[model samples]
Target: MTSHYDWRGGREAMMRFGLADAPVVVIAPPPFEEANRLRALMATVARGLARQGLAAVIPDLPGTGESLTDIAATRLADWRDAFAAANEAAGPVRLIASVRAGALFDGGQGAVGHWRLTPQDGSRLLRELVRTRIAGLREDGREASSATLTEIARNDGIELSGHWFTPALFGDLEEAAPLPAHPLRTVRLDGDAQPADHRLAAAPLWRRAEPGNDLELAQLVADDIADWMRTCLGG
Candidate 1:
């Protein structure tokens, strides 16, 4: 079931699954539009974890999703602490489950390992977000440069695409790179893995034009994640 609790100067929401136990993999969310696209899949992953006799918590990272708090006040540290809170709520984190740019915030603070999905370098993700927003502005007949979209947060603090990014958040994202700390247990590549023939090489789910809950795709990905988690935790 989904639950909410005080976390990192805001309340974070998470969907808890099966025989809640210690050392959960707190699933760090992808930021902005990506989060909207991947939310269903993430929940499916938690359900898969339960089926595997493991517990997982898919958190609504601070300033996003159900926690619509002061997004402008949010920062990298707040996200890290939120991870810890989710871990504490479940116990020690066996793994920090992260998706896409979300891997940028993996604290590795108290985790035994990490599990990353569609892993992306931080700076690249930020640039992608900027590009996406810029294209969006063009569609609206607004000629906005990536520079303006990138720094407008410092001025208007407006919602870009779907979520708010404050100046502080913008700076952190611009500087983010692959996490330098955590030793990952697994990285499930979807569409990024080799050989175009691979099943995981399907079109990116998070980039879908229309919002969808691809339960079939979600379950397939979830089962894959569960299998990897099992391997990481040792069969």
Candidate 2:
């Protein structure tokens, strides 16, 4: 069962798979422009976790999704505050995050375990963002390059691809730290295979002009995550 409420000043859209006693896993959604493509998947995964008898709390990042904050004024520290607030309201739990770009914010400190899906380092993600932006502009009949976009957003700000792209924010995205070392449970629902290969071969859904929620793929991801959690922590 899912419910909505406010906690620690952040409005949370939660799905309690079962009960409060059930173990919880705070989900960190993908950050920035790609968030829309992954939000449904995150919610679906929460339902799947609930079916496996776990609770999931998904908090809207400070500057995104139902948040009462301005994206332009928001900084990484604000995101951290919202996440920490979710932690306070969530009680004891684990951390399970999907979408590689958001890995920088997971913190991974107090959780009993970490389950990251499609994790990528910051440098790679930032490079892709730049390329994607430039390509998008070119397609729009405007011959904008990475250097140009970087310069523009770096100077003021630009609204493209549903994000208020900014130079300062891009720098933060570039500086995101890597995940905590292994023995930290991680998985890749898509991308590559090799049992535990975490390399992502497919492009992000957010790149699509009209991103579709592939329910089939979402379900598959949910099932895999639930099974992994059950095995690792037991129901």
Taking all chains together, each candidate's TM-score versus the true structure is 0.83, 0.79
**Angstrom error at residue 177, model 2:** 2.9
Per-residue lDDT of candidate 2, residues 64-94 (tens digit): 8866767887666666656656655675656
* lDDT computed for candidate 1: 0.70
Candidate 2 runs further than 4 Å off: 1-17, 181-183, 189-209
lDDT per residue as tens, model 1, 1-235: 8886666486777788777553466778787788888777777877777777777877777777777767778887788778667766665546677777887776646666666666676567777777887888788998987777666766666566776777777777777775764446444545464332124534577878786676776666666656655666666
Where does model 1 exceed 4 Å of error?
Answer: 8-10, 151-158, 186-199
Model 1: lDDT of residue 121: 68
> What's the residue-level lDDT of 218 in candidate 2?
58
Against the reference, the lDDT scores of all candidates come to 0.70, 0.64
Q: Relative to the unseen true structure, what is the C-alpha lDDT of residue 211 in candidate 2, on a scale of 0 to 100?
A: 48
